[model samples]
Target: MAGRVLRPVGVITETARRLSGANLHERIGLKAPPGELKRLADTFDGMLDRMENLVGAQRRFAANAAHELRTPLAVQRAAAEIGLAGDPPPEKVARIRTRLIGVADSSEHLIESLLLLAVSEEGLEHTSPVDLAALAATELAAAEPGAGPAGPPQDPTVVRGLAPLTVAGDGTLLGHLVRNLLANAVRHNRPGGRLELSTSADGVLRVSNTGPVIDPADVPRLLEPFRRSAERRHTAGEGAGLGLSIVASIARAHGARLAAEANPGPEGGLTVRVRFPLPEGPTPAPDSIRLPRN
Candidate 1:
């Protein structure tokens, strides 16, 4: 009787001791009658399942990050090598220099995005009141500094359907959320497509634009790090595929709801909506709080 009770405990202990990254697929999978020890073994198996999933996610993120960071570095190295080879002419040198600068700038943007994503994942330490409507209008109105010769001319027709809306969160992260939404919308749009955004006092911000057709099933995956939609690859000079993922992380940090849907029209596009929680209390009248005009 004593041996029978101790047998499962000993087995679980031994199995746990032998577990490692290479063996996450292994399970205790003990066969026993229903009781406290049986319950314990089942719980242990469940914990290992979660651990396996978490470890797998970290591994994937690391690989993707490495690959993304490597691309710009490789470009920089190749440009430098060409410049130094055989004493290049002044014009060629200048072009090489310019290319290097552009690659460096791209690297900087990627790093900044990675840092913001990291900060968002750690959760917010403090909170402040941020007006979603004003941020959307400001970002929508601002010129696209990223638009170089090869980039889009920000040509999409813009419509402002904003209302004064406020939510509690880090204002910077919230601003990035709006900026990224607008940028993603604009970058993937058609030449004469229409861009629209609206903010409601009820804590919802929505941006929609016209672009290439996308599968509805890919929407969720697009929110993951480095995931890009096949249809939306028209903008080759656009982003490192971190735009929507950062938005998703910031939304999670702020305890907000975020959704992206592919447009059903003939001209394909995406509509991303973020819903933040409104603070408890009556919202002040529009006249009471000064907001940015569209």
Candidate 2:
């Protein structure tokens, strides 16, 4: 009996040593005879599967980060090269200046987004009761910079919120989540399009925007880092495609559920809803927060 048990252990040790040289992306599962050794083998195989998935995700994230960073750097380099080539006329100089400034702005936004994503992955540093409705109102009042000037002159957002709708989470991260959602909605909207933001006392936050019709299948991809719709790709300064992904990350950190769907109509759109669980204690006072009706 001792030899049988010891044999399985010996085999597992040798197999592990042999496979240790394999890359993280490679999955080499172990097989064992029926009995206690089989259970150990199954557990080891499950662990290998998890490690593979984690490594795969990290690899994709690294590749996407490099690609996103390269674009802005390339723009800046080209602008510098053009400016250095010769003494340009006033109009050309002004154009170069504008291009450089735009590149700088985009780079800054990308860096900020990356930092937020990294910090969120590590987990929230602080936690408190945050009023989602009031936070949304504040973000709405302040127009997001660098969203491009393509939309209609008039603001198109409709806000319907219940006061004192709060959740226990890090204020900074929660605020970021709200701002990202709002910015995304405004940036993607068409000229004279409509945006609806609503928050309920039950800890539900919904942001819906009118834009080009999106395929239902594409909605999931939109929540991944560095994923953008074809239309958004053409629109300069829209964003680095990290808005919804960061929002999703922040929501996960706060234990909230995020649901995204494409709106149904001739002019299609997207709607994202985040449902946060209420705190365990007493609730705050009720106050209605409404934006000016369109």
Candidate 3:
């Protein structure tokens, strides 16, 4: 009888000692009778469940980052090899130079985004008041002059409902969060679509745009790094595909909730809302909250 109860306890400790990324799939799976030992076993297995998820996510992130980096590097190599071969003409050389510069810029952007995502996930190191309304207005104005994301149609009719809404967080990350929301609005919108921006004292910042129809089921996964719609609405040449992902990360760092939904009517787009926590305490982290598609 002494060995019986102690056996499961020993198994639990051994499992934990040997647990690693490679062995996260393993579990003690203690089959002992109901009691303290069995409960402890269940608890240990539950911890492994959470650990498996976290480790899996980190692995996926690293793989995605590698793939994102490889594309730009490949483009640069191709431009160098093909464009400079056999002493190409002056015009051709100029085109190659421009292309290389553009590729370099895109690579830089991707690297910065990857680093920012990591930092945001690690939580904020500094906290201050960040005005969502002001940031929204600034980004919208920047997007209005055809500075919107690449490959989008004519500028959308932007309507603003700005109010002085400030939240406590890292100001720089908050600014990026706002910029990404506007950029996503424009990038996914149709020609002559509407981009609506609104903020209120409740610490809510809302952005809606008209674009291609998105599946309700796909809204949640859009928050994943490098994730894109199966419809291929945004291609590899488009932005780094981190816009919504970064927004999600920043919101998480600020202890806010981020949600997105498909817009109504024939001109379909997305409506994303970020609700910041009151200064009293951090809101619980919301990994995949989204609005019902209409």
Q: Please list the C-alpha lDDT of all candidates, in the order they appear.
A: 0.86, 0.80, 0.84
Per-residue alpha-carbon lDDT of model 3 for 1-294, expressed as tens digits? 999658887898888899877989998888867999889889988988999988998898888788888877888999999879997999999999998998888889889998898888899888988777887788777766365354345667888899898889988898899898887887777777898999989889898989888888889888888886553343544587788999999999999999899876788889999999866666656876676899
Best by TM-score: 3
TM-score of candidate 1 against the unseen true structure: 0.83
Q: Counting only residues 3 or more apart in sequence or on different chains, how many pairs clash (N, Cα, C under 3 Å) in candidate 2?
A: 0
User: Which stretches of candidate 3 lie above 4 Å from their native place?
Assistant: 32-34, 145-153, 230-237, 280-294
Q: 1-294, model 2: which lDDT tens digit per residue?
A: 899668767766765676642554343344555777777877766777787777777778899889888888888898889675787888888888898898888888889999999888787677887877888888877754335555346456464555568888998888899888888887777766788888887889998988889999999989988888773373474577889999999999998999999999976789999999887875655565455799
Q: What is the lDDT of residue 22 in candidate 3?
A: 90
Clashing pairs in 1: none
Residues 1-294, model 1: lDDT tens digits: 999779999999999999999999888998999999999999999999999998997898899889888988988898887675898889998898888888888889989999999999999999988877887778877734345454445477787799989889998998898898888887788876788899987888999989989889888888988877653452345678899999999999999999899999788999998999988988799889987899
Clash numbers, per candidate? 0, 0, 1
* TM-score of model 2 (CA atoms): 0.82
CA error at residue 136 for candidate 1, angstroms = 1.4
- Residue-level lDDT for 128 in candidate 2: 87
